[model samples]
Target: MRLMGLDYGDKTIGVAISDELGWTAQGVETIRRTNRKADMKRLGELIREHQVEEIVVGLPKNMNGTIGPRGELSMEFAEQLQNTFKLPVHLWDERLTSIAAERTLLEADVSRKKRKQVIDKMAAMLILQGYMDSKKRR
Candidate 1:
């Protein structure tokens, strides 16, 4: 079954999807959040198109392993996703995925403008890949 990943922010939500075998994740697109209804509608379309069976949302916890405001926001968003999609929504710790994505892009010599546009989607892919890897290890 396929899985979807999301990196939710105040202004945008990065989206990624796993391969049918769930072995790899690919960045889909970044959704610019204008309102909840629109966001949910777009996500519903992606969910149906990808045949997503589950969702993984990035939870931004503090470095000290404490849940901060951002973490709470992510949890709330996860709840909304679960309620809307009627599918399991897992929260994956996203401590440094963005930083890692930035580093990866820099190493690849991506231009700053392009990096700015794609960093969130890259982070979503990283988060999804991490969750898929953990499931494989189990």
Candidate 2:
């Protein structure tokens, strides 16, 4: 079984896939959002290609652990994914994931343009990694 992770945003959806053992998550690609049908079609293709059995979506919650508008959007996306794919979709807290991704990129001296191109994918990787790490802790 394989797991997929998504960092859903207004402009793009960052995609990540776990290894066969579910130990590591690797950034796949960033999907630029056009419309729901197109977006889902692309996602379906990835799911099929990866043989993904489960999905984890990043939910951007407030520092207080309260779901905000962004988190609500992620929740709706996750629900839609569950209904459309008939696969279990989990929401993982994504507070500061993007910030962390940016910090890492900056520390590596990534050009601003390059960082812009890959930040979402990096964030998705972090989100998935965090979720997998939490599972390992249990």
Q: Compare the candidates by lDDT and give the number of the best one.
A: 1
- Each model's lDDT comes to 0.96, 0.96
TM-score list, all predictions: 0.98, 0.98
Following a full C-alpha superposition, what root-mean-square deviation does model 1 have from the true structure? 0.6
lDDT of 1: 0.96
Instruction: Give me the runs in candidate 1 sitting further than 4 Å from their true place.
Output: none
| Model 2: per-residue Cα lDDT over 1-138, one tens digit each | 689999999999999999999999999999999998999999999999999999999999999999989899999999999999999999999999999999999999999999999999999999999999999999
- Give per-residue lDDT, candidate 1, residue 50: 92
Which residue pairs collide, candidate 1? none
Residue-wise C-alpha lDDT for candidate 1, range 4-75, written one tens digit per residue: 999999999999999999999999999999999999999999999999999999999999999999999999
Q: Which residue pairs collide in model 2, if any?
A: none
